[model samples]
Structure formats: C-alpha cells, structure tokens
Target chain A: MRSVATNSTARPDAIDERILEELRMEPRATSKALGLKLSMTEVAVASRIRAMEAKGILRVVAQLEFRAAGYNILALIDVMVADRKINEVAEALSRIDRVGSVTMMLGDPPIIVQVQAADSADLHDLIVNHIAMIPGVEQVETNLIIDIAKWRTGSAQLHPTSLPG
Target chain B: MLVDDVDLAIVKELQKNGRSSNREVARVLGVSEGTIRQRLKKLEAAKAMRLGLVTDATALGQTAAAYVRIKARPRHARAIAAKIADFPSCSFVGLTVGRFDIVAFISATSRDELVRVVDAEIAVMEGVLQLDVREPVGYAKHRFDLIHIP
Candidate 1:
C-alpha cells in the first residue's frame, strides 16, 4: 500500500492550478472542453494533467459518500495500545474492511481510525469482537459522527482562503 | 437510493479508475455503453457518488495535519462546528457524540500553521470549552477510494 506521506518535490505552476480548479468543479470534463474553457489547446491541457498524475500529485477517482452508500454509522475510534505493539495493532486495524483511515498519533491513545458500519450492531462487533480482540489493544474510545457540517475534499488545498468574517 | 449489484460494480470499477470511459467500462463489465451511462446518471442523481480529483496535499506541501476533538457549550456544538468547518485548513467538521461534541480534521502547510489554526483560531472561539489536538506521527492507511459497500 502507498504511504500517505509519499513525498515529491514537484509542484504545480499557476497554469496547473487553474487546471486543477477546473477539474475540481467539473471532474469529468474532457480535455477538449477544458481547453476551450481555459483558452489552451487540448494537448497542452491533457499533457499537464498527465504530468500531475505522473508526479503522484493528483488522482481522479470515484468518491463515495459513506452515509449515502448505506453505511449509516460513521465513528472515530481511538485505541490505546501497549507501547511496543502500537505499530502492530495499527497495521492490523488498517487491514480491516470496516476501517476507513488509520493514523498513529502522539500521546495517550496512540492510534485513531475512521470506521463505518451498516448499523450499531455491526459497529459493536467491530469494536468488541474485532478491534478489542487485537493483541496489545488496552482500551478503545469511539466517537460517533452525528452530523457533518463540512466535508470539502481536494478543493481547500488550492484555495486556502478563509470564509468572510 | 436503491442501489443494485450493477450500481455497485460500476462504482467499484470507477473506484479503480475514475477516468474510465463509458465504452471501456461497458467492455469490461460485458454491458452496453448506454447501460453504463444510465447507471452512472442514476447513481449521481441520488448523490450516492461522484467522480472527482483527490490531490495529495502532502506532495503539495501541506504536510502538517491533525484531528481536533472539542467539547463545546451545550446547544452551541453544531454552530461552532459550522464555523470551524469554514476554515480553509479544516477539511472535515462533524458534530460528534461521546467524549467530545465536535471533531475536525485539518491540514496545513507547516507545523506553525497547524499551531496557529488550532491555538489562535479554534481554541479562542467562545463556545469551545475544551480542545485536544492529535497530530499523526505516521499514517498506516488513508484510503478514500475504498468503502464498505454493505
């Protein structure tokens, strides 16, 4: 699996940022269409996109809304583990199908993960039967996401402008 | 939002390659281009899914990231969450239940930016009673493409 911290010194130029902005708004827009909108030739636009992809900076993918996809319960699970086995437990958690994202954090609860389940029962099983059973997992805290006020994906990275005060 | 096997297959296919043309998907799935097009239209109309570009912020220099759990004053959690969500650094803002009333995920260009947003901005908000920031030492997995379909 690819690490989240995949490094690259390459950066997008002004033109590339404009292309990304356009793609953010219309992901499926063809190169020819984007060329027309951005006043660039189709080959130029397509080549720039290809360069970004080659550099591992951008990926166009089908983003699924978990709640809408029928996995109603979304919870953040923080796990306290035996210090020596923290990495082992995190790796195990990452392999689980229900676990969405796993990050090893600093301090008391060394691991945190976003998990989804079809219902409360499944979530219970995941925590009790699956996660809790993992070796070195001393404790678990779950925070259920009740409502999401904002979930901007890739858009915010380019436009770091804050909302009006 | 009644998704069938075909819908799931289409989504699964696109999850692997979002830019796959309708004809390519049709060829792979042994279906007509029209069927692939119609299913995609239906899935999108229901807001079940969408094709989009996911940028690697780490590659783009936003290396610092963290999850902030907050305890807020009663009845103000949702409002505070909405405000927090508006911050450009915050990628996710959700009202949660358990130890904290709100949870937010933020990524910034540097550690200093992360500290500024969490300390100077979020902590000083009126309704924020308590806040705990957890910075990732390392990420074992961060999969946005995969989800439990069941």
Candidate 2:
C-alpha cells in the first residue's frame, strides 16, 4: 500500500497568516493580484504560496455553489450504524453519487451525513433507496434545511480579531 | 439600543439576501432605505453579521474533501490544534469530548493528494496518538440552520 509520509510539523508566521487570509476570501485570485494586495512581488507571492502548500498551511480550491449549480434541496441526515459496520457504511456512502459530505459524529449513533440534491425526490431516492441499502446502516433521520445562517469552508471562518458581540 | 421587531425583520431579510440593495430590502421590509443602511452598518460594526461567499470545490479541481479525526496527548491538545489549523486542509477543527480529541476537514484534487494529506501531513502533527479519516460522499445539508429573527 502507498502511504504518504507526514513529518516536521511547525506553526505558522505572520506572512503565512496574510497569505491564508487572501486565499480564504478569494481562492482563485492570481498570484500577481495577491502580491499586489500584500505588497509583495508576484514571484515572491507564488513561492510563498507554493511553500505553504508544501507545508500544508495553504490549499487553493474551487468550492461549488450547490444551490446555484441546480441542487436545491438540502438536508442533514443523522444515521445510527452498527458500531462494527461504521467503516463499511461510510465506504458505501462514499460511492453514492451526489453525497456531498458524510461526517461520522462523535455522539449518539456515531455518524452524521450531509447531502445535497436537486429536489425532495432526488433526496428521497438517494437516502431511502440507496443509502439505506448499505448493510451496516441501522437507522437514519434527516433534517431538511429551511434557511442558512452561516456557511463557509474552513479558511473563511478564520478572523484574527474577535467578531462584534 | 436593543434590536426591536423592525430591526429583527431587517436582519432576517439581510440574512437571506446579503447583497440586496438597501433600497430594495427597505421596499420589501417596509422600512426607509436609510434605516436599512444604518442597521447593516451597525451589524457589521458590532460583528453580529457577515457576508458569506460560497463556491464550488469540484469546479476548482478539488475533487476530494474529507474529515480527519485525531486523538492526541491531552496536554498537547491546544498546541497541536493550533498547528493543525494552520494547514489549509484543516477546515473545521474543534476540541471535542468524544472518541477523537480533534476533527479537521481536508480538500484534495485527486486520490494522490488525499493520500498525501493523510499520510504526509496529518500523520505528522505533534502529539497525535491516532488518526481516523473519512471521506464525505454526499452532503445532505450543511447550511446555517437559523430560523428565529431575534
């Protein structure tokens, strides 16, 4: 089996903080644009970014606007899987189409699954028909989202200063 | 001043349509445009509200995203968490009272990158005792579930 090596973990510095902040706001921003904003040369910005990526401090990704992409129905499903079959069920879920995020929870049934679909019918088919078919899945409960208060990926959540209380 | 019914109505509308112009929101909420502007500015200043930008990771070549749970030395939990959070892959990290001490989300463009993240990056965090990782196959719902205006 091919396994990646992990070693030499270290903390981040001020420059790292600035670079991460820029990427968080706009992941697709060009190195030159980022450089202009940070007052660093484009080459410098590029190298710093690459270094961070290498160090695992920064990752540039394209995040989908699922709703805009035509997936309208959103639901949070909590599943109670047989303790022994959690891995099996999780692997099965990973194979299902349009399964956005399958999170194994810490408390209770021990798994929380998040799914996005085109409509209620699509959601129904995925969960009732497909997900439930997995051998280890014992029980499932879903909460359909009515509104979104705060939602963003990891980087976007970081704010150096405290938010107004 | 405490937020009253009118202010609450304005907040609810803004939460739904963050970029809606003050004039437009005012028309919908039956408030003056100036009132909308003042409330919004106050919200930002008070840190009670923020504008969010959502994107597509798959469109940007991030084909893989997963959550990794790590059990670490209790004494080194905070230090390890701070270090792990520095990684871009560490999307959501929290000190949990469960089987795992820390949880993080990682994004990768391919199988190789995902493996690299698990093997080379997360495995090396100081004081980590054990690691369990899971890849999310689908998202049922991961939005902010806010209903009450107050």
Candidate 3:
C-alpha cells in the first residue's frame, strides 16, 4: 500500500471512512454488501474501493493459515552480512518458502529475517544449506519463538496512531 | 476444517481483491454463484478466513523500526511480552528461546518517537532486564501471510 498522509490529514470523507471500517472488519465483503450497508449501489462501492486502493489506503493480501500449511516452527534470525551485500542477501532470503519476512537494519547485524520452518531440522537446513550459502552473510543467530500470546497490525493500531490520537 | 480446492480458489480470489463479488468470483472460477457463497460461508464459519489490512510501516512514515531483544526475570517473560504487545507502536511481540527471552518488532514515525517507546514503554516494563535495540533500515521482503502457496 502506498503510504498515505498522516491518518488525520489523509482522512477520507465520512463514506470512505465507513468503507475502510467495513473492509477492516470484513476483508471478504462484497461491494454489493458494502453498498447495501451504506445505502448506496454496488457500483458506487466498487468505484470507491478502486479509488481508495489507488491512493494506497487499502490493500488486499491473501492471508494463508500457515499453521495448517505445516509451517509451525517460527524463528527470528539476526544476520550479520558484508555491508555492501545486504540487498542481495535480503532478496535471497525472501525467496525461501520457509522465510516469512526479512528486516534489513542500519548497523552491524544488518539483516533480520523472520523464518517459519516445519521443525528443528528444517531450521538447521535453512541456516546451513540455504541462508549460509547466500553471499555476504557473516553470522546467523536464530531466536526460536517459543510462544505467541497476541498480535495486531495496521497503522491505526500501532504506537504512532496512539501518539497522534 | 478441511479446505477443498474450491475453498482455496475462493480464498485466492478474495486475497487478490477482498471486495470481489460472488458473481464475479463465480464467473472467473467457472463456479456457480451459489457454490461460491456456500464455500465462503463455510470457510468463515470454520474460522479459517479473515479480512485484514497489511502494509509496510516504513512506507507509511514509520521510519524507525527495531527488534527489541529482551531478557526477562525468569517467569516474567510472559508479562513482559504482554506489555510489549500493549504498546501502541509495537506491531509484533512474542517469547523466544535463545540469548534473549523475548523478541518484539516495534516501529515509530521518527527516531524521537521510537526512543520514547523504547525508553518509556519498553524499558520501564517490570520484567525487562536488558535489551538491544537494532533499527532496521527497511524490509526487503515483508508479508504477513502466504495464501497462494505454489
């Protein structure tokens, strides 16, 4: 999604706000249903959605039930790489099916990758065979996620939203 | 709940366009509108599907993002994770097994705002003993879930 102006300045009209809220609550909602809820025609809701998406206000992402896909093991790996090769290493990490997301940082250990594996052996294989083979990687530290208690996303829920509110 | 190919197909279509109408989905996938609606209802009932917003925080003006590696006092890791989760800026928080007991992903709009979260919110948490804050420049590959598995 394209970054919008701050939520305040980028505030949509009352109707768009309602659309966003509705989409947020039900990502699978049809424009017809949304139109009915807003007392508008399906065509109206569909056009508004297209406009919002063009502005980077909303993005539709496929949410796979990863656990069911047998990707149960989750780990956060802090990677130290040759300063110049961070981009290459990050791109390689992204291609791996077991890797969830890679975060490239500013300092010493420049790469932080969130990985999901099937088990301990799978993680070891990723580190030794896949990630290590990627050029420029210096060191790898894997922090196994023992438990996940809670989670949330979207700019509206994070701290920045809190401060401005 | 087992998701058949049709169910996966519906999820795939909606994943690409959440607001896609059942009629449209049926037309593209060559299924009847009734079948599409039935599969969607079953998937939703099974709690295997949900709607959400996914974004790259940095792209949204959240330039400061760091992995806060933390050590908690024995059983206090759970409490500390809950604290990190409650912080408005913290996007993802979880307990880990390694050098650190807990690892969290937090982000803020600016360096100053990020520090405030670390200093005031994370540092002062009851169980946090020590932490290493590493600000990542960007996320080369960022996605919350995988729907179209090849």
Candidate 4:
C-alpha cells in the first residue's frame, strides 16, 4: 500500500473541492459521470483525483459498521505504561488484530487504543491476554462504547467548509 | 443482515480500493459483476458498510487532535454525547461505560483551537461532572478497517 504524503503542504483548490463534494455524495461515481456533472473532461477529473490522492488529501475507502459486521462490542482502552516504555507498549498493542487504532497520548495513561471484539468474553480475553500482558503496561481501563452519537471520517472532518447544502 | 462469505469478499475488495469498478472487482474475485453489484447494494442498504473518502488530517494542517473523556450526571450521558457530536471540532462522540460517560475525539487546525474547544465549549457544558483531555503525541497505528471479518 502506498503511504500517505505526510509532509506535503498542498491543499485542495476550488475545483478539487467540488470533486470531493461529488465523491462525498456518490463515492463510487465513475470518472465519466463526474466529469459530465462537473463540466470537465473525464481525463481531467480523474487526473485531479489522482493528484489529490497523491498529495494525501483524500482517497476512497470502505468503512464498516462493526456491530452489523458481527462485532458485538466496541471499546476504547486507556493504558498506563511505565515511564519511557510508551512507544514500546503501543507498538505491541497495534500489532493485535483486534486493536483498530493505537495512539500514544501525553498523560498518565500514555497509550489509548480503539478495539473491537466478537463479544464480551472475547473482549475480556483480549484485554487480559493480549493488551494487559504487553510489557510495561501497568493498568488498563476499558471504555465500552454503548452508543455512537456521531462519527465522521478524517476527510469529512477536515473539509467541513465544503459540506453539501 | 446476515453477512455471508460473498459479502465479506466484496467488502474486503472495496476496503482495499473503494473506487474499484464492479467489473474490476468481479474480474479479480472471479464473480459476476451483477453479483458484486447486488452484494454491495445490500451491504450498503443494511448500513453494514460505507464507501467514502479517508484523508490524512496531519497532511492537511489540522495537526492538533485530542481525546476528551467526560463524566456526565446520571441519565445525561446520551444527551451530552449528542450535543458534543454537533461540535464542528468533534469527529467522534459516543456514550461509553467506564470511568467516563462520554468520549469524543476533537480535531482542530491548531493547538489553540483544540484547547479552546475543550475549555470554552466542552468543559462548560451542563451535566458535565469531570473532563479529561489526552493529546496524542504519536500514532503507532490507525487502521480504517474495523476488523478482519473473515
């Protein structure tokens, strides 16, 4: 998989923003369809998409609603780790298939992760056997997400100004 | 809403490249384009899957991000989470069970904006008992895929 451009200072332009808006509405719209709607050639539209994707501005991806996908539980785990061992514990936790995201924070529980499990027993085992067993991990606090009021992908959050009316 | 092997296969293909045409995915998976199309429609209609753009916020200059955990009064967690979800700065707002009643992920263009949202907007809300903010210094992994269904 190609790595996202992290250091690029590029931002999407007006035309690019329009393309993004169209995609946001119809994520699978063909380039030909988009070009006709946007009054640009198919090639031009596709090229702009490629450019923005290369700049790490955006790329289409499939997002799952975990509950419907057979995952019964979603939880955030806050892990307090030994001093100077945050990165080590984080890397280990990230390797777990059940751990969806691992972020090293700047506080007491230096590592936080989003995790999913098939059920309560699965979640219990995951924490006790996988996460808590990681070296340097002192304490683990599990915050089971009961209901999601709102959740947006990073792309949606970044371009709120271009939201469709 | 039962997810079969075919549904998982289709989702896996789209997870890799959401823009992959039905014909392309069918060709790769050795299934008919109509089957692929039909499964995608079903999965989407079931709200089991979403095809959308995912971006790197750091590359776009929205570098400041933090996770705010809120302790809410009894029976107010859901309402507080709903209100917090409306904030432009919060990308995620959920009612959780643990030390905190609600948890939100806030992203802003700068650290000042992040702090302002946490202080002036979130902390001052009614029913808020306690609030803790944790800023991520680094990310070991942040996969968009929730889990490997297969």
> iRMS for all predictions?
7.7, 13.1, 7.7, 6.9
Q: What TM-score between 0 and 1 does chain B of candidate 1 receive?
A: 0.90
Per candidate, native contacts kept equal 0.66, 0.03, 0.54, 0.70
For all the predictions, what are the DockQ values? 0.49, 0.04, 0.42, 0.51
| Tens-digit lDDT string for candidate 2 (B36-107) | 888766754654444443323432446676666678999977776667666666545555545666665677
Error of 3 at B97 (Å): 0.3
C-alpha root-mean-square deviation, each candidate: 6.3, 13.3, 6.3, 5.4
lDDT by residue (tens digit), candidate 3, B1-150: 556788877877876766677899899999899998888777666656654665435335666777888988978999889777877687778898899998888878898998888898889988789988888776666655442221
* Estimated TM-score for each candidate: 0.88, 0.51, 0.81, 0.88
- Which lDDT tens digits does candidate 1 get at residues A84-162? 5788898888778788777889886799988889999999999999999888888999999988787656622222211
* CAPRI quality level assigned to candidate 2 from its DockQ score: incorrect
Worst 10 residues of 4 chain B by lDDT: B141-150
Q: Per-residue lDDT for A95 in model 3?
A: 82
After superposing candidate 4, which stretches have Cα over 4 Å from the reference?
A1-9, A156-165, B147-150
Q: How many steric overlaps does candidate 1 have? A: 0
Find the 10 residues in a row with the least total lDDT in model 3 chain B: B141-150
The runs of at least 3 residues in candidate 1 whose Cα sits more than 4 Å from the true structure, single-residue gaps closed, are A1-7, A155-165, B146-150
Residue A73 CA displacement from its true place in model 3, Å = 0.5
lDDT of candidate 2?
Answer: 0.59
Docking level for model 4: medium
